[model samples]
Structure formats: C-alpha cells, structure tokens
Target chain A: MNNFDVTVIGGGPAGLAAAIKACDEGARVLLIEREERLGGMLKQCIHDGFGLSRFGERLAGPEYVERFMDKLSEKTVDVRLLTFVTRIEKTAEGFCVVTVSRDGLERISTKTIVLATGCRERTAKQVFIHGTRPAGVFTAGTAQHFTNRLGVMPTKKCVILGSGDIGLIMARRLTLEGAKVLGVYEINPTPSGLTRNIHQCLHDYDIPLYLSHTVTRVFGADRLEAVEICEVDESYKPIESTKVRVDCDALIVSVGLIPENELAESVGVELDSHTKGPVCDCQLMTSVDGIFSCGNALHVNDLVDFVSASGELAGLSAAHYAKKAQCKVNIKIGNEFLYLVPQQLDLNADNSRVTFYFRSKAVREKSLLRLTVDGQEVFKRVYPFLRPPEMQQLVLNMDKFAVQNGSDVRFSIEVAE
Target chain B: MKSFNCIGCPKGCLLCVEEENGEFTVTGNTCENGKRFAISEMTEPKRTICSTVKTVFEDAPVLPVKVSSDIPKDRIFDVMREINAVLLDKRIDRGDTVIENVLGLGVDVISTSDILNRK
Candidate 1:
C-alpha cells in the first residue's frame, strides 16, 4: 500500500543522483521537483568546470546534469514535476508525504525520505546594503540566470561585491557580453572563492579585486547610480574616513549561500550550527529515523562530484536500512575545522570505508590532521596547505581505528613545526 | 622562471616552470593535469569560452553556447564575436552545433542546453 520505498525531495544534482541510485538498488523511488526543470540551478549555470573528478572532463553545468537526467529516464521511478510538499506526518508504520500540484493534492507513504534541498543565495538586503530600492541590484545567481538562461543583460556597467565563486564567474560572463565591470570589492583580506576561480575567472580577464574593502551604501532611487565604498579594520568595522564613491548601473552581490532546510526543520531534524544543515551520520541518516539528508541539505559542498558521492551513499543507505540495527557514535572535531560532514558514525553498520568532507577554519600551512580513538592515535595525514574555500574529502577504514560505543573518537589539527 | 597558479581545478597549485638548457621542468603542481597545463601554457596557451547566443524563441530568449574545442588564447575575443553574430532562428538541441568550423578554427560552437527546444 506504500506509494514508494524512497521519496526524494529535490531535483538538484544530489536528489537526482540519490533517486537514481535508489532505483538502481531495486527500490520504488519517487522524485519530487518543485521547478519545471529537472536539472535545478545547473540549468542556468552554463559555464564549464563541472565533473572534473567524476567524468574527468571539463563540462558545463547543463551538460554535466544531462548525463543523470538521461539515466533517470530509464528507471522505473515516478517523476513529479512542478509539485510542492505541503507537510510531512510521521505515521504508524512509515511517513506520509502530502504534496500539492496543478491537478490536486495527493498523499504518499514511504519508509525512507531523502532531503537534497540545495541552497539559496544571500541577497543585498541580507548584507545590509542600505539605500533606495533599486532595480539594478541582483544576486550573482540571478544575474547568471538573466544572462545565460533568459538571454538578458542584467547591467551595462556594474560593480561586483564579494569575491565568491559565483560573483567571479559572472564578472567574466558579463564582460564577455560586452559589459564593463569596474572591480570586485571584498571585505575579507583573502578571497572567498577557489584559487582556480580567482585565477581563471578574475585574473585572466584582468578584473581588479580589492581586498579589505566593502560597499556600504547604494545611491539611487529607482536605478542604481552609485555605491559608497569603505575600508574595514581588523574588527571588520568600517573606517569612516576611508570612504569612496563608485558610480555604476548595477551592484551584483555574491555574499554567500545558505542551506535550504525549512522542510527538514518542520520535521524536527537536528541542525549543526557550523554547517547550518542537518546533522547526519556516516550513512547520511538524519536525527530522525527513516529520514536522510545529502548534498547542500547536509552541508554546502565545493564540488559536485562529492555531492553525487554523498547522494549515492544516502540512496544506498536508505535502500539497505532495514538490514541491521544502527548504533550511532558522535565523532568529535576541534575548532580548527570550519565543519565536518558525517558528524556521527554508525557502529553497527559497515564501519569500513567512510568518507568525510571538511574544510579548515582558515588558511593553514604545513598542517597535520590527527585522528585519535580512545586516546590512541589512529591516523594522521599532513597537508602542505589548506584553505577554507577548498573542501577536502578523506576516506578512512574505520575498522582499523577500532572505535566502539563510548570510544572518544576525536579529530584535531596542528601546525607541523 | 615564470609562475602561474594552475587553473585545472579548485586546488590552486602555485606552478613554477623553469626552462634550463632547453629542458622544461614544472614544480609545485599536485597532479599530472597541472604538469600538462604548465607545458602547454609555456609553449602556446589555449582557452575555451562559454557564452550565450541570441535566439528567436520567446520562452527562451538566449541559449548557452561554447566552443567544441579549445582555441588559441588570443582568439577568445574573435571566437566570441563569431558566436555573438548568430541569431538562432531554429531551435537547436543541447550539444547541437550552432556554427560549424567557426572562423575556420575547426571548432564548432554548440548549444550547451536544450532549453530553447522546450517550446
């Protein structure tokens, strides 16, 4: 009487891969997509640089996602497009997912649910750019959509704020379309984007990047006319005397991205403060049993290859969940890490070969990561250098660590002097 | 010696290429891709460009396009011009060539998405 064995709640790279893997594992899967398109944000992201690790080819976003869409077509999974899940109720035997679409409302019951809800971009308002409400200010994602998907020039002359990856890519995209980008202003001392991005997207194009600088105010009534810029101190407070004005038609901001998890929160899933996403174990299972999370819903990932890897792991876990009893163990990490995925480990499950994704809190040179179980050093790896923007994935055979219930498994970083 | 960060991936390796006695050696690269990149970069740099093209479709105003192969780094602007000149009157599928042998570079400009064919 169940509608499906697995219900995937997104259509992005993560959800698509999760559903595909679940179906391949002989489970009846249902993929619900709120958007009309199945590829999610990748549809608007036409720039190449995707699938380097997975496919070993520099593919554009659309082309990278097309491979998954092609495989999804052959599966027996039910595809729901332009549908919205209103609420989820924990039933006696399983969970009830109530959805609404153009036709009407429908309820489906499933044993397991996978949340692959991607993320949202932070807007100018979120960053406190005060001024008149103008039409020229757009998030980097919106600008990319306008230019790549809709074939519209968002701005003729623009000033970009924030040195994130999206903003840098759009700078080049806008310039190629004959727009003049004045310069990219970032408040942080170091750029927030990947090194390859800063080099290829900004440096190769000769776009100037100003560090320790920020845009304070937008100066226009209807359209963007000019913006007030200033230098910030060590505390990130603006230096009042260092104010400057730059005139431009638009302000493209790529401040940051926040994981979308309202639905997960509604279900009372525990969220990690550092990642702003659901707390998951080695199998990607959430705090609530029968509910799993992957991709950006678990945490923002730097590469789509890792996103697919997590999705596949979650899908496989969901399919074989009923096989054994899951015993959870919290894996502790030091403050030197920005965040770590798989916050816990399932001792009862296969402890061999667990992949954990993490990033350094800041730039660290000649750093060594120490993994200890019960006060005994289990593993250690040295990194020549680590940056916050680049996420590193480490695969370990937990069996060798010999960690068990109540075992103090901790991860800490140290500078190799 | 000339230094350039490898653009192969997000892991930006500070690559230094030194040509001593006509023998080229690349240092600080983490992988083989970076090594090849250094050699090619030192010899003749090549680049690939991705942009949008104007289309007649109402629902989709513009379609994403990219060169089928890499071209000389200097010809990026020229390749962009060739792609911009075309106003696609017919709906083309993803990977479909919009311009064949564009500017006699033997590289075709292909649509990156099937968004235009939806209508």
Candidate 2:
C-alpha cells in the first residue's frame, strides 16, 4: 500500500501548484493526472493575457503553467500521469484513493487529499439547444483544444452561442486561423466575459456581438448547417416571433463552466448550491475531515491566478492538517452577489488573512461592500463599479472581528445613491 | 473625441481621447500604461498575438509562439501568414526565435514552450 501525506488530484495548474506547495511544506505529496501532460487546459490555451497578476507579466497560458511545472520538477512530489481516480474511501487514518492507469487498479493511502479537478464546460445540450445530435457542435474549450493543440480547424464558419471568456477568445482564435466567425450571440443583456476580453478578442476582430439573443435550435442531421437564433425576454424565455435562421457549419457554446466536484461529493463533502462546489472553510477545507477542495472544484474562478492561489492555500492547509474538531460558522451573503467562495470559517483554525472571492449579481455603477458581524458593521469597501463577469477578491483579517462559533458574519453590497 | 476601452490591463478603463493639432489628450486612465495604450490606439494600434506554428514532432504537432513585442494590429493576418508558412523541423527551447523581424516589424516570433525539446 502506498502511503502519502497529501494526494492532489487532477494535474492542472491548481493540482501542480498544490503538489509543489505540499512538497515545499515537507509533506509527502502525490499528484494524479488523467492526461499524459501536466499543464491541463493550459496546454490548449495558447493565448496570452494569463499570469498578469501572479507573475506580473502577460504570458501565454503554456508559459504561465510551465513556470509551475518547472518548480514542480525541482520538488520530490510523486506524480502519476495518465492515472484516473476511480473512488475515494474514508479510513480511520485518512483516505484510500483508488485509481486506474495503464498498469491497472491501485489503491493509495494519504493523510489529506486536495481536490483540484478544475471545471467542465457546459455543452450545447446542457444549455437546451434543441436539435439532432450533430458533429459540428463543440464547447468553446473543446474548440480551443482542437485548434490550439491539434492544429485542426473545427469549423470554417461558426456562430458562437455565448459571450463567455473562452467563447470570446475562440472567436478571435478561429478568426486568426482564417475561419469566419459570423457573430457572438449572448443570452444575457450584458456580455459574460471580462471587459478586457471583449475589447481584445471581439472588438479587435470586429466580430459582431448580439446581446439578449440566444440560439434556440439547430437545423442539421450529420453536420450543423444552420441554427435558429432568437431574442429573449426579461425572464430569458425565447421570443418566438424574433427567430432568425443563421447559416453556419458549427455552433460553439461557451454558456458557462461547472466545477467538477463529483469525486468530492462522493466522499460525502457538503456542496454549496450557489457555487455548485464543496462548501469550504476559509482554509479551503471541505466538510469532510482530512479533505480540502480548491481551485475550480471549490468554485469556478474567473482567473487562473486565483485558481493557483486557492490551490496553494489548500495545499498548505492539507500539509499542516491534523485530526481536530472544527468549530465552523457559515458566512451569509445578500442577494446582491452572484456567488461567494469560502462559504464558512473554521473558528478553531487561524482566521487571519482569510481570502474571499465574490461577484456581483448585476452591473453596478457605484456600490459599497459591507461586512457585518453580530449586527455590527466590521468592514466596508467602496467600489467604482461591479459586474457579474469580473470576480473580486478580498483578503481580510477575520481574527480582528472576534468571530466565535455562533458569530453572524454577513456580506452585502449596497448601491451608492 | 474618440472613445476607447484601454486594454492595458483587465480593468478596461473607458478612455476618451481628444486630438487637437496632432496633440492628444487622454483621460480616464488609471495608470501610465493606460495613457500610453490610449495614445497608441489613437496613432497606430498595436497588439501582441499568440498562436501555434506547425511542427514535425508527432508527439506535439504545433508549437505555441508569440511576438517578442506588440505589432501593428492591421498587419496581424500578414504576420499570421508568415507564421503558418513555417514547418519547424528543429527542436527549439522557449524564448527561441522562430522568426526574426517578422515581416520587417522588428518583432520576433518566439516559442512560448519547450514541449518539443522535452519530448
């Protein structure tokens, strides 16, 4: 039986960071990756504008991840490439992770486990694009993989169904590859991607963006030949009279990404409905003892920098984890937020320098984010503007608030008059 | 007055540029980079492009490359033509220039990864 201090799943940027940090903490760490390479999605993300916050330089995704891969090479973390985790069983000591590889099934025991499985793109069917199963339909990430990694063009002409970041980037990428991107149709009134992405990717290429519009149906049998695009009303119901047929070979969807948390859920970890991920504490520890969730498995993050940051924190916490009773308290949020990560705080653990990631429910010109504890205002910060697409990060010293087991920690954003 | 979204950073500040007698006045920039970006947008818009070049390696079909600096945005397709024409037969490390002074723009297309060499 193989035994380790920590086991980090999914060899993406987050997993690599976790394994490296855990190794640096002098803990025996094992990194499991389903793919042969370690870069994960970064391998397919050939675009730049990554690592602007972490490395302070706008680097290509591969370059950004390679920096961590370089650091990982120097560490003694045990890496298992082309290994898939099948099951995780809780034990008295810690956990027994069952995995399958070319060698066959094997079980490894670890004191603590870090979930960094990342997120999966919502497919066309998931977004309710009614049609016969076609070959040309692809998620934005899949299109990116085919184009950037395999050097294969997924479509000659395409209509992107979402304004998400990946969709916006692919619009530019496919255009650069001599493909004709007709237009990007977004269901929401406002663009779902970052302001920078909209400017750099779509606006730069002169690709038309139709807001409050969505693809309702596909009209093809073998390969996608056309799609029915229609405008939506306030409740997001498609307006039947506004249906317009757009001729295109492919339909690339970038509706949204959902965190890959099935493994965590299988381990009996409580999930937050808002994040669609594990309900985590300030240290990124999940409800399950000796188990921690980070990166996309904790919450879908807008930036890769924040994903790596959460992975590092989870790795550090896992490396130093010990079996102890936790005094956890929920951190409530008002309806103004789209979602917030680190849904709770373990009062028993160190509460200083707690990082919280959140997004606004809608666009706000001027607002103030207030933090209240036990009916008393503890912290507040004013913002010039807030948007759902752009996530915000705040690191606060929760120790100063004197948060106890029953402390009422509430977060709300108030629009400025 | 011409309005532009300064892509200097992710903040995407709405920059309003005014020109009078070949002199530009830019506002709504949070940093000096934003101001410089606005001026460049007004004069000659330049952008850094990252893409892949064909490689002979079976394990890695394409190698990612990016301009050493920003190039004229209008000449992007021209540069892409130059990039797509290359069939890299030699194994190069990261930061190795795939093309020097690409299309006489004074920007070299450099490999962003050493995946080929690693394999």
Candidate 3:
C-alpha cells in the first residue's frame, strides 16, 4: 500500500505534466502508467509537427515527451510503469485508487486524484460495418503503432477510412513503407483532420480523398480482398448506385477517439454530456471533489500542446485545493462554444492570465473568438479560421476581470469579421 | 472548355480551363488559392514523395524512411534512385539525418518510423 498527497493516473502527456507541476508546487505526487514505457501514445507518434507552441521548436512526439520525462527525472515525482488502475473509490478521508503492477495488487490513498487515462480509437466493432469476417483490418492508430514504432507493415494495398489525423498520417506512413494506399474516405464533406496534415500527408502523396463517403461493406473471408465505398446523404445514409468497389488487402479506420472514462464512472464522477468526459470546473476538479481529470481523458484534443497546457492547470488546481488556497470568482461556459474549463474562477486567481481551449460545432472562417462575463465581452480576437477538428485556444488575464469579481462569468465564440 | 478536377483539397474542385492562343483561363474554385492552384497544376505539378528504401540494418527487416521534402512529380523515379542507393545501419533512429542535404535540395532524408531495439 502506498499513500501520497496527490495521485496522478495514466502517465501520458497529461498525467506527466500534472505530476511534474504538482511536485514543483511542493506536493508529493505519484504517477502511474499502464504501458511498460512512460511516454504513452506520444512514444508511438514519430511525426515532427508537435511542440510548435509548447516548446517553440518543431519536434517529434518522442522529443516533446523526452522534455517532460527529463523534467520528471529532475523532480521528486514518483513514477510506476506497467501499472493498471482497476478502480477508484471515494472515502471519508479522500480517495482510494487500486492498481495492479508487476509487484502485484496495490492500493493508494490520496486527498486529490487526476485522471489522465487518455483515449482509445474507434474501431470496426464500434462502427459495425456489415461485412464478412476477414483479416487485415486495423485501427489507424494500431497500424501506426505497428509500422511506425514496431517496424512491421500490417498490409500492402490498403484503403483508409475516417480521414482522421492518425489515418492521414498512417496513409503517408504506409505509403513510405511500400504499401499502396488507394485513397482515404471521410464521411464528412470536409476532412476531420488538420488542414496541414491533409495537405501534407494525403495530397502530397497523391492519395485520393473521397469526402462525404464511407465504406459500406467489406469483402474477403480470410484476408481483406476488397471494400465497397459509397457516398452518403446528409443523414449519413448511403445513396444507391454510388457504391464503388476497390481492390485492397487492408482497411484502416480512424473514425474517432473516445475518452477512456471507465474508472471515472466507477468513482461516480459527473460527466459533461457533450465532451463525454467528466465535468470539470476551472480548477479541473471533477464532479467528485478533489478528483480531477484532464487530457484526452477529459476531452479529445486536436493538438498535444493543448493537452499539456490543460494538464498544467489540473496539477496546479490539485495542489491549491490540497492546501486550501484562497480565491474567488467562477468561470462558466457561454454560447456557441461547447464548454470552458475551471467551471469556477478565482478573482484572486493568479491574475497572471488564463487561457481557454474550446471547439466549434462547424467550420467558421474570418471570425472573432470572444470571451465574456455576464453578457459583456471582455476579450475578443480576429480569428481568421476555426474548425471543429481544430481546437481554438484563447488567453485572457484574470486581472482584467478581477475588478468586477462577477459571480457569473461566461465564455463563447462569435463571428466578428 | 475542358473540365479537369483540381486535386487542390478534399473538396476536389472541378476546374474549367480554356486555352486560347498560348494562355489559359481557369475557374470554378471556392477560394482564390484554389484558382492559383489550378493554374499551377495545369502548368507544372509537384507531389510530396514518400517511399521506403533498402537499408543495411537487420534488427528489423527495414527502417521506415521518407524524403524530407516534396519531389518534383517527374523526378519521383530519380529521387527513388538516390533513396535506394543509401544503406543505413540498424542504429537508424527517427528524425535522424539519413541523407544529409539530399540531392542538394537543402533537405535531408529522415526516418519516418521509430526503429526499436529487437528484444
């Protein structure tokens, strides 16, 4: 049995950042990761577009995580690798987190917890495509893990579905590995991945992209032989006669990412119906007091930079709540945008500054993302573009609004251009 | 007018280009960037090259590699030669400079995939 002031779960980018921050704030922290390695999914991602904003230099995912891992080594944070957290329960004292590692089953008690379980890929089982059972079907992430990290090519001729960032990246990765990528299929009329990724990964590779289309049926009983792709209407129903059959050996799906919140649910944390993660206040505390959540486990993030930044807040919040730091003012979600973090704000909240990360329902061009409190706009910016696929981050100084000390503050986005 | 699809974006804009004398007028694009993109496609096209080459390493069969820059559409075969000639040891790691300043294009060939130690 082990006890700590703070228990950080899932040692991915979020958990690592939170643990490091908590330790820096003079709190004893425990970081537990399920994988044998400490870096989490970032370890498998070999692309270099990461760390543009967080580190200022464009680096591969491993390099970006190496920085955090190095920081952890320098801090007092304790890390446990290959540890699976089975359940989390609240007690009269605080929270009890149960896990099993190489040593055996273990229990830890902490006053505050941070859930960073990350997310999982949506697979064919979840999509439920009507087809004969065949081999060579893989989630884009899984195939990427195999080919990019493990040096194994999953297949030769392939058709990728979902046009996700991972799928787009895999299309390029597979192509580089001597695999024939017929095309990428997306149900949405536009790409669900970042614009730069679409341009660089698929467009650059001459891999065709079929928008508003998806695979309706799979062929081949033993190994994937071919797939039937068709265009769909607005409601996602396939239009008749639009089916196009393409010969392929494999199908990689990158449909979407779902937050892995089973443990959170076991602990009875309130969930945001929209984000599908635990409902967290500005402090990153979940519905259950002192049980915080961040990273992809909180919400699927488009960029890892946002995940690290959000985890920093979760760490500081856990530290402050443990010490019962004083502050006032609560921030709330306003119109158009999905939800804002720190559900509550502190007027005295380190007036240094606060950055809000959010997403829109649809693509908006030449717009203004505005931050407001009680229907009055406090901050507004001319954002040339915004997309549901891309997260929009807005930073504002709490000092600007600390004077008002308004009880009900809200944040939202609107077009001003 | 001849209709050719401009593979500019996922939108796949169908371009209407009419050539009179020696100049071309292109239209049917959603953005101004698309308009310029269509003209460039009709004139000279370049595509990003992504392909693996033989390596000297045996820890794994091959080390996944890629051209550091977009290759001229016509020079793809030529680029493949340069990529094929090089043989890297199993020690090749991701983002490592596989071919320094490849083809004098100021871009280095790099490993796109991480090659882990075979345990």
Strongest candidate by DockQ: 1
lDDT of 2: 0.93
Question: Higher-DockQ candidate among 2 and 3?
Answer: 2
> Residue A136 in model 3: shift from native, Å?
1.8
Residue pairs in collision within model 2: none
In model 3 chain A, the worst 10-residue window by lDDT is A340-349
TM-score quality measure for candidate 3: 0.81
TM-score of chain B of 3: 0.70
Report the number of backbone clashes for model 3. 9
Worst 10 residues of 3 chain B by lDDT: B4-13
Give the higher-DockQ candidate: 1 or 2.
1
Per-residue alpha-carbon lDDT of candidate 2 for residues A1-417, written as tens digits (9 for 90 to 100): 399999999899899999999999999999999999999899888889889889899999999999999899889899999999999999988999999999999999999999999999988888877878878999999999899888889999999999999999999999999999999999999999988889999999999999999999999889999999999999999999999999999999999999999999898999999889999999898999989998888888888999999999999999999988889999999999989989999989998899999999999989999999998999999999999988899999999998888889999999876
Off-target runs (Cα >4 Å) in candidate 3 are A323-335, A338-352, A368-372, A398-408, A415-417, B1-119
lDDT tens digits, residue span A25-106, model 3: 8888999998877778987676666776776664667667867887898898888889889988778778888889889988
Q: C-alpha displacement of A282 in model 2, angstroms?
A: 0.8
In TM-score terms, which candidate is top?
Answer: 2
In candidate 2 the C-alpha lDDT for residue B54 amounts to 96
* TM-score (all chains, Cα) for each model: 0.97, 0.99, 0.81
- Residue range B51-75, candidate 1, lDDT tens digits: 9889888878888888998888888
In candidate 1 chain B, where is summed lDDT lowest over 10 consecutive residues? B110-119
